[model samples]
Target: MSPIIENFEKSVNTLLLVSTLVATVTFAGAFTVPGGYNSPGKGFYIFVICDSIAMYSSIIAAVALIWAQLGDVTLLLDALHLAVPFLGVALSMMSMTFTAGLFLAVNKLR
Candidate 1:
């Protein structure tokens, strides 16, 4: 219950909230693949890949947070640090997904 531990908890809580929101958004995205509502699309694979990465990374972050809560005080920092890579991957994948969608749109318009 030191100030440092308290601050760490606050940060972890923030990360948990963010990871959960990402998971929710990706979960929703999974059900609504790109361009499916309008026309046949070639970016379904990109959408699925990005959604999978986002969903799994967010889940991993959540699990790491939960696990951190159950162990030594130092575990929280380690968990968050470890989770950073997953978040990075998710972010890159999400960017790629958008790029793929944009490319598809350009191609379709041509």
Candidate 2:
């Protein structure tokens, strides 16, 4: 393989590695929700929902990463293009998490 192909493979491998870590972390977080939900407030529910979305999005990202590693350049490009929506889902989940955190903080002071 050429130097450029080698470099691209390395970059793809790194992306897969980081994506795996993110999936692991987000999936772990799904089990460790904030406030324990003993009272089941709206914020807690939102947190759980966000965590679920993040977990699923991370799962899709992992699939996409694997997809990207397989097949030729055209296939890789198609797989990575699919990953963009998963990326957006992950980003929205992060934003939801922040909003949930703020909601929790405010409720705590109430």
Best by TM-score: 1
Model 2 sits at a Cα RMSD from the real structure of 2.6
Q: For model 2, how does the per-residue alpha-carbon lDDT over 1-110 read when each residue is reduced to its tens digit?
A: 67776676676676667556666766776666655557488888888788678767867876886877875777666766776578668767867876885677567663
RMSD of each: 2.6, 2.6
lDDT string for model 1 (1-110, tens) is 79988888888887778777777877887776656655555576666777788789888988888777775887888998977677677667667766766665566563
Which lDDT values do the candidates have, in the order given? 0.75, 0.71
| TM-score per candidate, chains pooled | 0.78, 0.75
lDDT of the structure predicted as candidate 2: 0.71
Stretches of model 2 off by over 4 angstroms after superposition: 1-11
